[model samples]
Structure formats: C-alpha cells, structure tokens
Target chain A: MISIRNLTKRFDGNTVWENVNLEIQKGETVVIIGGSGGGKSTLLRCINRLVEPDSGEVVIDGVNILSPGTDINAVRRKMGMVYQHFNLFSHLSVLENIILAPMKVAGRSREDAVAEAKQLLARVGMAGRENTNPADLSGGQKQRVASARTLAMHPEIILFDEPTSALDPTMVDEVESVIRSLSEDGITGVIVTHDLQFARRIATRVVFLADKGICEEGTPEQLFDHPTKLQTQRFLYRSRMFEQDLSPETLDLYALASELRAFLRRYEHERKQEKLLPVLCDELLYPVLKHPEAPAAGASLRLLCSETSSRHTMMIGFRGIDSDPLEEPYLDELNLALLNNYAEFVLSRKKDDGWEVCIQM
Target chain B: MTIQKTLQGSALTVAPEGRLDTITSPQLESELRADMNSVTDLVFDLANLTYISSAGLRVLLSAQKAMNKKGTMVLRNVKPEIMEIFEITGFSSILTIE
Candidate 1:
C-alpha cells in the first residue's frame, strides 16, 4: 500500500506537477494515464526517490519513504522497475542479467540465483533463450528477458514504464500476454503507459494524471468510457494513434513534441525508443498554405504555426482498425500506447489492411 | 426493492422503496401477486421511490394493470420528482395516482 500527500516535483524551477495526493491499496494494480509532461513519470520517480520531490511524504505499508531512519535501498528492494531499453548488461547472457541484481543486492548466492533465474526465464516464455546474448535476441525477446531479470529480484511490486513500446508489431502481443498473466497472479504494480486496453484489462483501478494532479480515479470502465476531464479524453485519443503511419519526413518540431510525450509515458513504463508521428494533416495544412499573407511551405512562420496548434487544428477522417487489440496473445501486460501524438491523424486502411475503430466520445 | 405493507381492513397499501431492479423487482411482484385474492382495495405509496429504470417501470406498470382488473388502485403521495420522471417518460397516463 502507498499513500502520497501534497507531492511536488520541479525541474530547474519548472514545476512538473504538484499537490499530487494518491493512495494505492495493498495488492492493487493502479495504472497511470496522461499526456506528456503531465507528470506520470515524475510521480513514479518521486515515489522511488529517483527524483527528490520538492515536498511531500510517500508512505508505503507503514514507513515513510523519505523518513530519516528509512533504509531507502532496502525499501527499494521490495520494488522493481522494468525499463523500455531492456537495461541488460550487454556482456551478460540472458540468464546472467536475471541473476545479477538478486546476487549483488539481495545477496542471493550464485547457485540460488541461477536456479531462480532459470525459472523466471521459463515464466517469461524465454526458457531456452536464457543463454542467448542480448544482441542475439529479438526486441520482444530482449524485453521478456528483461522482465525475467526484474522478476529475479523477487520484489513485492514491479513498476513498468512502457514495457512493450520497444517490440515489433507482431512481438507486442507476446509481451502483453506475459504482463497480463503477471497481473492475474495479483503482483501489485504501478504502470505508467499509454496502453488503454492494458489498464482496462489488468488494472483493478485507473488514475488519470493531468493538470498538475490526478484528474480522476475509478474503475477503467468508468474512466475510459466516462472520463470527466478534457485532458483524459485527449490522452486516450493520442494513445490510439500510435499504430498509424506517421510519414518519416514529418517536421522536426513535431518530432520534438512527440518525444516530449514519449518521455512522460516512458518515465512510467521505462521504454527507451521514442517515435515521431507525421506532421499536420491536409485539412489542417490547407489553412496554413492558404494563409493569404504567409510565405511558402518552408517558411519559418508556417513551421511555427504548425508546431503550436497542430494537435488542436488537425482532424483525422478515419478511425483505423485494431485487430486483436486487447486480446493480446503475445505481450502480457502490454497496453497500446498513443504511438503518435499528432492530432491530424487518419486511420489509413491501406496500411494495416483496412481496420475500422469503434469511436466513443 | 424493499416492500412495506399496511392493511386497513381489506384495503391494503404497500410502499416499495429504493430501486426496483431486475434482481429485486421479482421479489416484490411475487409477494404482491401471491396474495392478490385477499385484497379488495389496493394503494401503492411511492413517496420514497427514487429510481424506476426500465425494469422497475415494467413491474410497476404490470402491477397497476393487474390491480385495475381486481379492485381500485391508487398511487398515493406521488412525489413531484418521481412524477416528473414518469410524466417525461409518458407513464403517468397509465397509472391511477393521487
């Protein structure tokens, strides 16, 4: 169980979020959802003291995380974080990565760590691949191995920051499948992700983070379909766009904006690779082009305008299909993230073989 | 649905409060219809009623129609709040209310 009151985080005087109050009950899975810079990751970091919050106390079970007498590392040992980059020691084998943390920190013996690592590898569906090097494994396999590695720590709760963002399309389901199983087993977790379906399926409770605080907390069925905040609606829409094609040559400004959002989501689930969605839709672009007073496409003014209000200006005509979206047979605990943050998105059927999405306001 | 019965000679008044949902409506219906023959006048006190979703509405309608064929049926203390909802949904015309 975790209780946070009046939590605040700032970066060089820029406040990321403040007055954040949350209480997560024991054996509960709380999924955090929000847009970039909404403080999803910063909140997680503050909890683990990875980033010292400006103020507040985080009490886990009974002890305050910031207590003078609290043994931070010892308390952290009960919590494990999985990174998107698959933070495996490149020189270490899959089996070695799993055993390393437990051996060094938990003081697990070599023989005991090895035995536990093998079992973890099997649990994550990488039983025979334990001996494989990080480079030899596929992206999804690497993440699975990373998960097994984290599991080796034997923490009471695991925190994931976009665990499936690095995997290929086909590989994502595998990672999600694994996570779903872990959640079914009731392994308490606080995941920061753009994956709506993951929260719907695996989370016992969902908290929408935005506007310098928690926008709302309730059952997924209530928040996803019946969210009360304008920010939550926007975040959910952006998350669904990740699967669509964003032409590679989109403007740098748009790319930068995309990275900013990805950073926030990653801070929660720990994904390393970030994506940039295609810039300004045609309907949105026409207004910029026909600006009777503006210059050409490459004009600085045109670029500046696009970066400022592109999300609000553009409208995608289609809602693409999500085949096997939630029935993630592959990636366990993986939820679909808003891969693209650009507002002017089109659900191009030509790309994903023509998928129609169910739309809800 | 929770039911409270008050008997004045053969004239019986029953107030079923709270929700009359799919899971609870049947209990009230059974209790009422099971002893229908012993009643001459019937009155339903709906003052405490707050919600009448479709399932609840259906039961109330049926009971009213059944009572119409048996004896006098009047809905007493029909709160304005419930009355407005019934009127909006065009259910007020179907029931005898005071």
Candidate 2:
C-alpha cells in the first residue's frame, strides 16, 4: 500500500528523479530498476524520508508519508530496511542487534522483543548464531542477522537497498533466501536495486528510476528485452546501472548467466552420476507405486512401474526432484490427500505381477 | 531444496534443483530475493523441473516484481509440458518465459 506521485529529487544541479509517479498495492512487491545514479535508492529513502526529495509526494496506505511534520521515526520503523553492507552493531550480540531497534523504536518490552528476535533470527537463517558477535559471523550470517534486526521492527513495508552488494557470489544465496521468505509472508516491499536478475526471478513488477526520476515502470521482461529508453537498454546490456546524484544501483547479468550455466552444468554432471532409481529389496515394484509422490514418469520410473517383481527404492528420478525442498511439507500433504482420495484404488503391489488387493493395514 | 549461487561481480545466478512449490517457494524466495542490489539479470533453467503449480507461479510473480525494478528475469528451456501449464494458467501473460 504505497504510492508515489510526480516524485523528483536532485543534488545540486544533477537530478536523480524527476516527475516520478508510482503505485504499489498491498502485498505487491514493486521493484525500482535503474543504473547507478538513477535514484532508485533515493526513491525508497524518500518514502521513509531517509532522503527527502526536492518535490513530489509519497503516500503510504493513503497517508501522505512525504509531507512535512510527518513522524520520520515512525515512518522509518514501518519500513524494515536491509542494507547491502550488513549493518549489524559490531559490539552487540546478534540477539541485541535485532532486539534493540524494535524495543527502543517500537517501544516493545525487552522480553517480548528478545523472544521475537529469537524467532526472527532463526527465520533469517541464524538459528544457532544468536550469541555470536558480528565480527565472528560469516558474511551470509551477518546479513541474516541484519535481516532479523529489520524484522524486529515489525515494519509494514520492507525496503531492500542492494542488500547483497557486499557479499561474495557464494555467500549471496543464503542472504537471498532470507528475503525470499519475507515476501511470502505477504510483506509489502519496494526493492530499489540494480540486480535485474534477482528482481526478474523474485519481483512481481519492476519500476525504473531514470530519465530524471522514477521514469519508466513495467514487468522485468519489458524493461530488459524491450526497454522504453536507450538509457535503460544501455544499462541493461552492461548489466550495470548507476546514478551519481543518487544511490548507485546495478550489476552484471552476463556474468551471472555464466555462473548459472556453470552451476547447472555441474547439475547435469551430477545427474549423470546419480543413480536413477533406488532398488527396493525383497518387495514388489507394484507396491511402491502406491507412494503418490513417486516419479511415475521417467523411463526408469516406467520400467519400475511396469515391472512386476520390483522392490526397495529411494524417492529419486521424479521430475519434481528439481523442485525446491521448502515444498517438501506441502508435497507430503498432497501425498496424504492422494492417499485419502484414492485409498481403495491405491494399494501396495505384490512381490510379483499383481497388487495386494486385500490388505487392510 | 538446495540452491547454489554462483556470482561474478554484481550479477548473481542461482541453480535450484528440487520442486519450487508452496513449501519450497520459501527457499526460492530466500535465495533469489536478496540479489536485488547486486544482480541485474536472472535466469531459471527448468530443464529438470517435472512439476509446477500455482504456488510456484506466485514465487515467479514475486521474482518478476523484484527484477522488474532493475533488469529482467527469464525462464529458459522450460519443459514443453510445463510451458503448457503456464499457457493454460495464463501465467505466460504475466511472466517472461523464454
């Protein structure tokens, strides 16, 4: 529930955003895309008043957030922000960093804040790291703690300002995973970033801050493949976007594609090396088919399903094998539903040639 | 689900193998959403995917929004059948699938 109208910003004579108008619906994540100096981050700052714009208005859930006299601290608290630099307080324990803001700014009790901090820390992938100091933590761990700290504030909207900019390629995934979880909770977001790949894969709509200010907006595909402006296209081709007057935002897509290619290439190798099916010992093949999540479709799967005396197996070779494991529980639930719906038709197979037609348990 | 991120500079690439559905959408969400600052292009190669549902669709929507802010997100080599599902559900309209 955020809206921006004719928003503009400039430092000296250089303009970051000009006549930038945008809207973000509740639970809808809107990404602002542009190169460095395009004012992507400035746009977000304007919303929270982190960087006051020269002109234009920011409306949050119908409240004109950019108005003078608005509560800046309150506005800041409502939008949890995760910075790229992993802004955890070095002196404090991980737990304190998360609890401090919420307890102080939100006026939450120490006990309650701590309890919530613990839950959030775990959610942000630092379950066992609460007592650790930032100096002792890994880059990924540090960023997660920062995210937990942001969550502590219980903001209505979360703003990500290139949260992974400082991370190594490998370490970025862990942090990325945390943000992904935040969106599913239906937290409204305004992510100002130059990482088009991240936005493409994770965002719902992409907004561009360019040609003066929040200039163009569209889906990731529209901006990347058929950008409305040459500047947008140039930034896209370089995979680097930035603005000197505003916060810099941009990255490299080609390098990312190569990395992905290499990783997926490795997957192919692993797939080739991996055993296609698990051999079930002593049992019949038909019986295993009763498992609803069973692959049911590969050549190997077909062979097992067609064979009469097949036995002992691992749940492998299914197409869903590539699916994210976070869905495991839901898959389990779906399996249960299948069991409930077709209990009678579904049966364990005999060690040979047929189904166990009469077994009750 | 295990997702490995291979990055060069600001660009980030993720290889997630395993179902990306309601349960696992969280992991995909976690793994892909953070690169908003450093990554400009995103590609999801679904050559291994065998199952996809609306839950998966929602994650794609979220990612698209995230990337839309900066660059672009493309789904490449989606299985023909999975592509059919996208077509059937009209997700093809909202997402940029290659």
Candidate 3:
C-alpha cells in the first residue's frame, strides 16, 4: 500500500502541481492520464524518489521514503520502472540484463538469478530470446525485456512511463498484454501515459492530471463516458480524432476502409461498428465521387470517434462544388437506401464556395 | 485485380483475385466485353476476392443484364465481408450466387 499527502513540485519558478493527494491499494492499477508536460511522469518519479518532490510525504508501507534519513535505494528496490525508450543495456544479453540486478542488488547467486530471469522472460512472452542483444530486438521486444528485468527484482509495484509510446501499431498489443498480466498477478501499478485507450483498458482507477493539479478521478467508464468536468470531456473528445484529404479521382476505397478499420481497432470498437465502417465509406462517400457535378479533388474529411457515445461522426467538406450531393435530384435510390440503413442521421449544409455533409453512425 | 478465365465448350468460368474497385472494375468490364458473344454460361468464383466497390457492382449489374438476353451468370464462394456489401446495396437479390 502507498499514500501521498500534500505533495508539491516545481521546476525553477514554474509550479508543476501543489497539494496533490492519492492512495493506492495493494493490487489496484492506477493510471495517471493527461496532456503533455502536466507532471504525470514527475509524480510517478517522486514516488520512487527518482524525482524528489519539493515537499511531500510518500509513505510506502508506513515508511516516509521522502524523508531526509530514509534509505532511497532500499525503497526503490520494491519499485520497478519501465521507461518509454526501454532502457536496457545494449552490450548485455537479455538474460544478463535481467540477472544483473538480482545478482548484484539482491545478492542472489548467478544460477538462481538466471533461472528466475528465464521464468520472467517466459511470463512476458520472450522465453526463447534469452541470448539476443537489446539492439537486435524490436521496440516491443525491448520493452518486454525491460519489463522482465524489472520483474527480476520481484518488486511489489511497477511504474510505467509511456510504455507503448515507441512501439509500432502492430506491436502495442503484445506489450499491453504483458502489463495486463502483471495487474492480474496483484502487483500495484502506476502508469503515466498519453494513450487514453490503453488507460481505459488497464486502469482500475483513472486520474486526470492537468492545469497544475488533479482535474478528476474515477472508474474508466465514469471518467471516459460521463465525465462531470468540462475539461475532461474536451480532452477525451480531442484525443480520439483524425483528419484526411480525399481526391475523387485517386481515392482508393479499399485502402481507406483498411485505414478506418485500423483506427477503430486502436480504440477497441465493437464488431458491428467495424463491419459498418467500410459500408459507410462505400455508400456515402462513393456517391459524392460518382455525382456528375462532383469536384475532381479538394474534399476534406474529419472523423471524431467517441468512446463516450454510440455514434461515430464524420464531416466531409468539398470545395468548388455547386450542388449538394445529398439533394433529392442527385442521390440515387440504392445509394439512398444504403445511406438510410447504415447512418443514424445525415445532414448537408451550404458553405460560401462549397458545402459540407455531416453523417453520424 | 487478376482474372483467371477457363472456357470449356462455351461455359466460361471467370475468377477474380484481389479487390474489384474503381481502379480495376474497368479492366474486368473490358475483358467481359471482348468475350461476351462467344459465351452462353458464366460462372464467377469469388473465393479469392477480398473487396468490391460500387463501380464493381455497376459492372456486375450490366453483366447480369447482358447475360439475361442469351445466357446465365452465377457467382460462387463469396466471402462474408464482400457478401455484406452486396446485401447493403441490394445486389444480393439481383446477382445469382451459388
């Protein structure tokens, strides 16, 4: 168990946060999420005394580790940290990197440390990669090894600082699964990240850190779906969004569909929504291109997919178009039927030079 | 898109592999045009077809109309993702699937 009382931090004259308080139970995974430079990572570091707070009581198991006479190294032995860049020793093999801390810091025998290292590697899905160099592995692989190295210390808590920040989109799931398994094993975790979707998946309790202090804190569903604060709502809405430019002559519907599928997959959308996304592109977007008066290029598309709401909304704005594509005389029967069936609502409005259509599904 | 055609005694089987979209549908339309008069029975194997767009559907609709005059056209082994597209556009009712 850990508790923080009256925490404060400042960099030169700029105050990061003040009077911050939080509590962590034995097995709870608490995720601290917010925009960049909000002291989320600094708060995590202050817990381990990696970044000393200007004033605070970081009491871990009845010991105030932030106090003057406290043994910082001994306190840190119980807390493991996995960094964004996966700070593994480049010259050491995977096994050696993991075993070094256990043998040197914990005073375990080489055979004992090595055996435990192999088991930790297996737990993180890197079982057969014991002799591989850190430089030889992928970003995801290196992070898993960094995690295994941390686990070798047998710490009661693990602190992750943007664990998936450097990973390829395809490799994020592998690292996320490892972190999820650790929570299942009843290790208290404090993760600071910009990734809201990952926080939604991993957090037992969510904390929103912004504007120099705690903005809100609640369960993932309560915070993501029904945040009471206006700041939290705006952050959630703006985080899961994308924009693109469409060229009618060169647009590849299949490629666009795949791109949309990947974006939805990142947020862990429902199967029904996934199936309908491509249909939305084909029936709704394709009709605009097929319209006789449609422009050759310069169509702007913006999509905002909200985890808080059931609807996924898209706005398509076209320049140099005289007529609205959704008008009665332009839209064909089959395409209209598909549009009515797939979308919740469709509206078209006029602009100075062109027009825009907003569809919600 | 790659189309593999097998013609045995006027019954032609045309199998398209990969996506049938705006870019590739015209190629399929021209291929069918070149061989239309010599064929009586048409079979389309869609087992390898990954996707289809409205342009592809228009080509299929015209083929079905042309086949109605003197022959029959049938599609087989449609993947579920592609079949949903057909069902959405009401092509499932117009095209014969086996």
DockQ of each: 0.00, 0.02, 0.22
Q: After best superposition, candidate 2 residue A180: deviation in angstroms?
A: 1.4
lDDT winner, 1 or 3: 3
In model 3, pairs of residues that clash are none
Q: Model 3, residue A157: what's the lDDT? A: 95
Identify the superior model by DockQ, candidate 1 or candidate 3. 3
lDDT of 1 by residue, A102-125 (tens): 888888899999999888888888
Of 1 and 2, which scores higher on DockQ?
A: 2
Error of 2 at B40 (Å): 62
lDDT of 2 by residue, A23-116 (tens): 7887777887776666677777788887888888888877787777777676666788878777778899988888887777778899999889
Ranking by TM-score: 3, 1, 2
Model 2 residue B57 distance off true place after TM-score fit, in angstroms: 56
Stronger candidate by TM-score (1 vs 2)? 1
Poorest lDDT segment (10 consecutive residues) of candidate 1 chain A: A300-309
Q: Candidate 1, which segments miss by more than 4 Å at Cα?
A: A237-361, B1-98
How high is each candidate's TM-score? 0.54, 0.51, 0.57
Each model's TM-score for chain A is 0.67, 0.64, 0.70
